[model samples]
Target chain A: MVRWEPGAQERLAAAALELYASRGFEQTTAADVAQSVGLTERTFFRYFADKREVLFAGQDHFQQLFVANVAAAPPEASAMEAVSFALDAAAVFFPDERRPHSRLRQSIIDANPGLHERELLKLARLTEGMAAALRDRGVPEPQATLAAHTGVTVFGVAFRLWVGEHEERPLGAIEADVLRDLQALSPSVR
Target chain B: MVRWEPGAQERLAAAALELYASRGFEQTTAADVAQSVGLTERTFFRYFADKREVLFAGQDHFQQLFVANVAAAPPEASAMEAVSFALDAAAVFFPDERRPHSRLRQSIIDANPGLHERELLKLARLTEGMAAALRDRGVPEPQATLAAHTGVTVFGVAFRLWVGEHEERPLGAIEADVLRDLQALSPSVR
Candidate 1:
């Protein structure tokens, strides 16, 4: 019988990231991660499909957050506003405490092509999910997709700033700054 | 001694796409594509690293076209305008003759996760390349990246319309229509 163990998933994820950082992603094994967490390999498998998935364990939850926030935005909001609302809602997930882990995770991803591709896939999925949510809110096609993709782009730029070595600003501040920058990207401004 | 033959690459690509459409991408092989083109496997490898690459053989040329056009746009043009010029230039590469092949390629990519991921990566590379070109043209940061990515988004939407079974418009027309739609997506416009 499987026993309910609180924080097992978090423990496994932390252990996996630490191992990936110290030993390189390619050299790390499921057994090493499980052992570091004082858990069995079976337990590790229960939390992640493979070592790479440990880095993306929160993707589904994050995607859900984005979709739910977009759906919850006021109907009067424009497509871009709705998308910004979703991104602002998603920003709460990245707190100050997670900054160190996020930094390490980004480095690990940068070092591995497979992980980089998975990250891109996750972002792509989030974009699609956001677009679908906007459509459900009576937003039209092409615009919905365009706005959703733009939201992802905003999030990406903000994320880099939020996690930069010299950046002490909160993710929310970075997001607002990035959104303003996006608005300033008008053709007439040049 | 290997003989240099004209149109060998094009013939291989056409044959590969035809086979992929008829027999499925997974079931098709480089040998089969070569045989279909009456060429040796070595000759096929000379043009593409693998069977999957046959669909993406034009990516490099297209990227060059985008960067060159962005650099060649009028110096006073806005970042978005420069990007639009690049997209308009790249549209020439996808004339009506390539429409059917493009349609089939999109279907194949939609049906396969690997191919879909590859397509996204290709687009990402093009976006980066365009951003660099924009920067080289004295466009500033954030706006440069934003404009380049938005250009890719416009290209994506226009490409879909241009290749849609019911659409009869040329790529350039669709690009203009999509760019107009994007401009209309401002927050004030709803």
Candidate 2:
């Protein structure tokens, strides 16, 4: 339940992306982004550690949404379905208002090795968070971890599918495709 | 296959690990490693781009070996078992002479954030390589990728299992336990 000033953070991120697209990540500074966003440098620092952090602040929010969804998932849901429920919950958190900025953030992160590494670290953290959430709900060891990983892998594919084209699709659709992909891999199904 | 000066790379890795352990990675110079191994710094540079490169020089070699094993694996083997066969090949490749150095190498890579990130990148590359190899051998798209990832995930668990105090289990045994763990997570088994 970490509290964040989302408005300030979003403004800073938007400003940072503009600077990065025009200049570059290495050329842009937090002060420059803050100035562009009509905020003090201190305000920018309050939201993010540096320019790299701006691209990833949403990951923690997404992780929280994932855990909360998993915690409250229906008992009848399969392990993979529980994961889908979480992704659906996350889509609600990432509204249309944020998609353009998110796309820009992703682009910048993709171009930078340091940011890419942090993205991997964030994914690992989210997987661990999901595993912990599953464990709290009475799922056993290794399965809990493996299920969490399976969820991330599916999410990875679903996300790629979602972002592959500019048109938006419901998170549910993306998740369903991921489940289909997973089932298609099953020995009996294959 | 790319040719290597036989054991030259391994010798350099051993020398680098010893220096990194004693003097720390940041403090250790390439010249010091070469001096310890009674080789010229020129030879070391010819083998690796720089000092940091020494720690990761074997990653491509391991990936190639794993992919080749996957390609040669029995067609009838389950996806998990096919992955296990590749991992077993890796287990056999673990050098008896490099046990102490291997621990030190893992420690050095673990302690450094940059090194650890590169290691993850390497793992991601290997996962893709395995997927491509599987696909070439008639495995399909998502299944090929999933099988590769599942194998890599189990390898991670086995590596952790191998490192701790209760280290009597051979690598093969640890990998077997990992496979059992994965099957135990199956919907029917759970």
Candidate 3:
């Protein structure tokens, strides 16, 4: 039985993730993802290249979000401040409603070495994008790159906490906690 | 005619890297690598699964070095200090004679997306391994992860500088400079 749904792309993506989680990514096909959503393989192809893309399709947009937010920071902001702003701005990407989905997606990624590598690559790209944005804001070589990397690390740490079982705090709050932990890494920062 | 060599694996790896750099990683083959070194494909197989292993064969040893150094840090050292000690300890992995080879290898990786992803994954694992080491030394969750990530970032930035043209400093000195730059990111740290 097939039924039409609004946001065909979103539905297909969701279905692909679910199928990848249960059946394993290698076992899931494009047609399987589409059929799970009561859609056709043609419709899935229109939205994504394959089942693997269901996890990575948002990477470019996510990188853009980090870059844009960094670029939008106030002129007086330090490189770290710019990254801090970007980190806060990234919370919209994981609203209260999206945590469960994010957790599931993360689990799927963690369970597969190839998918985990893809996840790390995307985060590496995000760090590069943020560094470029910071450089454009007049932050110097190592500082821009360092701050960008730091922010991304915080994001990674906070994201895991956000998706963890007993954690109920928002991503921004967790990021603040992680940022503090980052600052406390040395006696100087303390 | 093949000549007996004292370091056949090293010779074949060197040949593989040269071929990959000149002809592109995708264009190179295991047989080509072996033939370039005056050896047979079967000999190459005994040392490596495929041509790609030429670039990645040291990853486990690399991770082990990091984990070992982190574990050997002074008991009273903070998470960041332990990472700093490990960073300095890693200089042995890149001697003056190896800089040119590393530079060539990095260039090859930068030119290939698959290789670049593998590079990032290796670094990510290094970070995780260091973090786990910190945890074993009694550092807590987010702080251990944060410090581990910051150290790896410094190592990355320092490795780039070490390999860059006109940079005369050793890997240890460049790491110190990058670590200083990382500390100066936030105003409080300054």
> Relative to the true structure, how large is the alpha-carbon lDDT of every model?
0.84, 0.74, 0.84
Model 2 lDDT per residue over A61-176, tens place: 77788888998899877565576677778667766666666677777777888777677777766777888888877777666777787777767656655555474875557666
Candidate 1 per-residue lDDT over residues B106-172, each given as its tens digit = 8888888888878888887788898899999898877788888888888887897887888888898
**Candidate 3, clashing residue pairs?**
none
DockQ category of candidate 3: medium
Candidate 3 lDDT (Cα, 0 to 1): 0.84
Q: What local lDDT does model 3 show for residue B186?
A: 59
Name the regions of candidate 3 deviating beyond 4 angstroms.
A1-6, A21-27, A187-190, B1-5, B187-190
Q: Is candidate 1 or candidate 2 better by TM-score?
A: 1
**Number of the top-ranking candidate, with DockQ as the measure:** 3
Q: lDDT tens digits, residues B17-79, model 2? A: 888988889889998898887777888888889998898777677778888898888888766
Candidates ranked by DockQ: 3, 1, 2
Residue-level lDDT of model 3, residues A1-190, one tens digit each, is 4554579988888887888889988899999888877878988877787677878887667778878999999999988878878887888777879888888888888899888877888888888888899899998898888888988998889999999988999998888878877887762221
Clash-forming residue pairs, model 1: none
Taking chain B only, the TM-score of every model is 0.93, 0.86, 0.91
Q: Sort the predicted structures by TM-score, highest score first.
A: 1, 3, 2
Q: Per-prediction fnat values?
A: 0.41, 0.16, 0.63
